[model samples]
Target chain A: MKGFSKLLKKDLILILNNYFLYVTLFFAIFFILLVNFVIPEDTSIEQSVYVLSEYEEGNKLIDYFKEQELSIRTLDSREELMQYMVNDFNSIGFILVDNQNVEYVLQGYENEKTKNLLALNIENMFQEFTNQIDIKTTYLVENNTVQKIPFNKSIVPLFLVMEPALIGLFLIATMVFSEKEEGTIKAYAVTPGRMSSFLVSKVVLLIILGFISLFLVALTTVGTKANYLYLAAITLTGSIMGSGIGLLLSSFFDNISKSMIWIIIIAMVLSLPFASYFAPNFSPALIKSIPSYSMMFAYKEALFPTGNSSIIGNTCILTFIIGIVTLILANLNIKRSL
Target chain B: MIKVNGLYHSYSNDDNYAVKNASFQIEKGEIFGFLGPSGAGKSTAQKILTGLLIMQQGDYTIDGKFVDFKKRDYFNKIGVSFEHPNVYKKLTGLENLEFHSGMYDVKTEDPMNLLRMVGLEEAAGKKASDYSKGMLQRLVFARAMINNPEIWFLDEPTSGLDPTTASRIKDIIKRKKEDGTTVFLTTHNMYIADELCDKVAFINEGEINIIDTPKNLKLKYGKKLVTVEYYDNDRIVNNTFSIVDEAERTKLNEIINKGNIATMHSQEATLEQIFIKVTGRGLE
Candidate 1:
């Protein structure tokens, strides 16, 4: 344990002294800030409906659309509503013909699903207007309360998972390659220090950096209200897995530049988790096979606690198992190469 | 402090052995040199001894224990300075020593003192990446001594240094010898083997041809003759005389007594010549 601590300290110092680590950190933080502040939030929803009406009940329909969290565009003329619907393929346009009639306008490229949803919404609005039935009263009574999260806030967890994973991958690769190039890795082979200690030291440093980046990201984007413990757990697991991958890949290359090309390639492949993040329903089984998929799923559950511990629990277990296996493989490769 | 018998090793991809049935031993406080050109099993033997390579078919012991490359404690008693400068380039010279010293369980020597011994005290704070080849070599030497190890394994210790630095390193090896540290030096430089080694093993093609002290090997392989240069009749002339024969000695003595001799010296073969003569191949 003492030897491990000493090695950990030395490696930490080396990592701190390396300029590339700071550069990677800067880019990670820059990307987080860019996502949070610079890039535009994805406010366009597929359920956007534009209403143009001369009737006095049009305000009530617009209020219902607003309550449903749909993008509502109001215009005074039917031409303006038609123009809006034509430009936005996923949008539906409604023009009031009389107190009892309404006309629906949709683009030619709109899919069947969009047309069906638009028809259902129009029928429900006509039913409410004609019969004066209060459907929301029953919904409000049963649900009691509803929680809404902003698009920017909901996507924060994905960045938290992604940024640290990237940082760990690049940071460990850079450190390992630098040591290999200088032949200091072979020096470790002849020392009293165990190979396990060396690998653990690198992993510990990566996890520490991983947590720091996660904290800054969470604090800046999500604020103190976010669950810090869950963020830490998910980030730590992701970082360990990332470091293991980095070590395994780095063992095959003698320099950073060579390893970097593979890092980019593997990173793109491992980015299957992003599909699981943005389009959870459309995610394929291949995406779930990726190690980070479990991590990203767990992060999502942690970000918005579903009270169903089974998914998060299973994801945590799988991530850890994969982490341990990769770590063992990495250790073997490092021992052989060194 | 070290012994090996019938040592053999071969890489998996190659059919031939790298060190085939090689054998040697070293006593305490003695400098033993494995003298050979590159690819002549000098490094392979050194690697086996230093625990970098596993001993596959050999009986070997160090400090009275069976050699085991898998044991971490074995490294506590040994120090290796590779031919290449293996110090961390990003670390300051002092930091590199300190970092490596922390690996051993034993009490280490002061890193600053080791730096001073290697004539690198002033540059101890500088990163190794900015150092010259000679400076890096000296720093590697300093790092090897950080643990005050009992056995020193040096591979081409003076290969890439100026004469002054190489002499300083040689002097340090001598001092270590006087301090009762067993030294296993590997080099192709015959001058180093001839000057510092108490005994040298001439190796070629994964086998040792001979092992003996430098003086004894030279005497056994060198010609027993003396060359005399004399100023005769206002012109310089030279003649070789067999030192073993009385008539040739008398003729050489008569020329010397007549005050016609300019210079007279015995012809002695060098270690390189003896290496080629014994192994049937030049060191190169």
Candidate 2:
């Protein structure tokens, strides 16, 4: 156990000296800032126009339109106003006063929130006004189901998929291969240290670094949720599996450059296609089979209500994969002599 | 003490045996030198003894207990320094020693002390990457001594060192011997073997050509005679005489008393000449 601590200490110091920890932290933070820039926040007000005629109800509606928070501009003709709205909708939308009914004149992507806010407020005012005159007015509102998932919400899981491969796998593989080339791996073999303990230390260090990298990215690019505990579990499991992959690569490839190429290839094959930009409707079977895919899906499900399977299943599969790979690498490493 | 009997090893399934039917033993506190040219299987034998290379056939034991290569406990009792110094480039000399020391069964000495012992104390804090080959070799020597094991396995321990540093390292080996540590040294340096080894084995082509004390081999194959040189009447004269006869000694004494004797010395063959005589090939 004492020897184990010394080995762990040396491993940690090597990691620190290599600057991998700092690189991961920097990449995570910089990536967050980059993603934040790509997705701008929405704070502008909705602008639309409602037209009214000189009829009693329309006059009442005109009076009501003046009282709403909608950014309303009035014009003479609906055709001219619609043209103005199309050209400068972001700046101002027009409301026309008429007799029987009110028509909304707005640009091409305009809908209820823009069109109805003013009409509803005006109808409310006219309803109060017509109530005083013993008359009735009906206002129509189109039911629109706009899925308001946060802009970065979907990307949270995608970042989770990338975190393991981009940061964890590369770092772990590089560390192990560096040691192997330096003859430190063979040196450790002659030590009284258990291969399992040595590997566990690496995985522990990798998990901490991996989680810190992914967590910072997760927090900056997308806000954390109430169930951060669940996110952490998923992150830990993914890191373990990713680190296992790294160990397997390091154990197999003596060349660091070749190992890095393999890592990039694996990361791309597993994560890029399942990313939302490429396949929003990624097949459930494919996602379940690939390790990163399941992790990304679980993270997205946690962020939003998208998936049916629980995070527990993905976590279990990741844990199993990690265990098997780690065991194999450990066995091979222990038997590797000078 | 280390012992091996009937050791056999081959590089591959169909390859010829690198070590075959080899056996030797070294008693406690002796510097046993294995002198052989390159490709004589000296390194392979050393690796098998140190547990780096596994033996496919043999009864191998260290300190009277049979060694199971799968276990690491036997390694704690021995320290090995490779002919090629394999040190971490990015790590400082001190850091390399610290890291390797952590792998030992028993922690022994301060890394700086080991460096100082090897005349590398001044360079201890420098990165091994920036070190010269000799400095790196000294640092490896420091690493090998970090744990102070009972047995030291050195393959060409002084290969890249300067003569002074090599002598200093040899002195350290002598000190280790005085402290009752057995050393298994492998080198093609017959001079070092002649000087340091209590017993030297000349291995040629994976077989022990001769195993005996350096003095005994010299006596067995060396000329038993002396050459005398003198100047008589402003002319140089030379005479060869056998040390084996008393009459020759009397004649040399009478000549020395009657005339001038410039130089006189007995002749004994060197280990290199003796090795060439035995193996019919020069030590490169």
Candidate 3:
């Protein structure tokens, strides 16, 4: 027990003294601010003219918008409206009113939230206006609901995939390679303690570190929309697999630079496919091969609670893969010569 | 007691054997020195004895049992100080000793005493990275005593230390020997060997070139011819003389009576000079 404690204490102190906690906090706050302030602002207002149409019977879209307590103003001409749209509205674009129909125009220059909110508000007005009359205007959104994830909610997937890999690889890779370079590990090869105990101590320490990092990243970024218990389980499993991979790499490479290169390559390769916004369609075969993709998938499903079966498949695959890899690496690493 | 016979190990098939058919016995309470230059399989032999490296063709035993290199249980009976300082740089000197001490599953003594023994008591709280080369080497030597084992394997234990510190460490090793613990030391420093070892083996290129007491080696390889100076007819003269038997002694006595003999001394050799002569190579 003391042997394990000594190993854990050494690894934890190494992580703490390196200011990894500060780095994680910095990234968490930066991610939240990036989603909140930087990602949801409009850059242009050339098409901010919004129009509401009157129904055939009586009610106009403006009256319905007014009834819904929305704040919108109407102008006479497109050029005259451009000033109102630019000055009065901080949105991307607007709607144009024609006889019995309404058109929503976006100049493709506003933030994502502004574009999405304008469309949602215009549709809500039409539904409200149609309800006022005796006409039944069907809603396409009622039939098919595209998930409108808020900017705050969108960064959760990125955190889910990046946290375990970055924290695990950085901490474990540095600690193990440092030990190797210092010859402490080679010394342990002749010690009476089991090598597995050394590895297990590292895994346990890293899992705790992973959870702390997850807690920080989550409290600052994903806590509101995230399920803490589910994230805990996913992060714990992901950290275990990550520690195993780190030990495996450490077993093979004695040089710190080479181990770091391998760690960065592995982190980038795994995190690239699950980056939902940037590379969403990275081949399904590749996605299935990565361990973090399943974690990301499970976390997303757990966040949304959309009853997606991919969550079940992802969880099962993640647990099994972690189990298999941990076993294999633990077995192989103990027998490996330094 | 430690016995190693017919030990053969090669890093790879293409590489030459690091330890080939090496055999030796370390009796209890004796300081046995393995004298060899670098790349002469001294460390390899130490590693094999300490259970760090496995041998393919060896039947070695510590306290009369075959060693299982994989399990490392034999480490309980022996302690090793590597040629390189292998302490954790991130840990304090005390913490380094404490951590390694925990690896032994037994009631252990205080690590501070060991630190004090090695003159690291004041620096115990300092991180190993901040330690000088001599300080780190002392800490490494301190770590080797944490287990209080019956046998000690020290590989170039005083390599990087200053003379005073090295002698202090050697003094501690001598105290351990006084406690009846077997000490197997590997060093190229013949002066240290001559001062400490009861018996020493000179190894070169994976083979034992010579093994004997430092005094016995000097005697066996020393020059038999003695140089003598005598005053004959008031003129100084020097002559070579051999002391093989009583007849030579009589001849020398007759010459001494006939003339005044000045100075006489035996032509003895240093261990280093004898090592060079035996192996056809210098220690360097």
Which numbered prediction scores highest in DockQ against the true structure? 1
List the candidate 3 regions with Cα displacement exceeding 4 Å. Answer: A18-47, A52-73, A76-148, A277-283, A307-320, A323-327, A334-337, B225-241, B245-266
Clashes (backbone N, CA, C under 3 Å), per candidate, total 0, 8, 2
* Model 3 agreement with the true structure over A1-338: per-residue lDDT tens digits: 87778777776676676666566667767776776667653433353335533333323556666666655566555665555555645444344455445565555566889767877876775675667656568884554544666656665666756766656766676777777778888777767877787788777876786676677656765456666777777777777777777777777777778767787788777776555444566557766667676677777766655556567456746754774486477547644445
Chain A TM-score vs. truth, each candidate = 0.76, 0.68, 0.70
Clashing pairs in 1: none
Q: Which parts of model 1 have CA positions greater than 4 angstroms off?
A: A45-124, A132-146, A252-265, B258-260
Instruction: Give per-residue CA lDDT, model 1, range A213-261, as digits (tens).
Output: 7777677776776667777777777777888888888877778887777
lDDT of 3 at A87: 66
**TM-score of B-chain for each predicted structure, in order:** 0.95, 0.93, 0.86
DockQ values for all predictions? Answer: 0.77, 0.38, 0.60
For model 1, what is the alpha-carbon lDDT of residue A29?
79
Q: Score every model by TM-score.
A: 0.89, 0.80, 0.82
What are the per-residue Cα lDDT tens digits for candidate 2 across B47-88? 888766667788888779898866877777777787776877
How would the docking of model 2 be graded? Answer: acceptable
Chain A of model 3, TM-score against the native? 0.70
Error of 2 at B115 (Å): 2.0
Candidate 1 C-alpha error for residue B39, in Å = 1.1
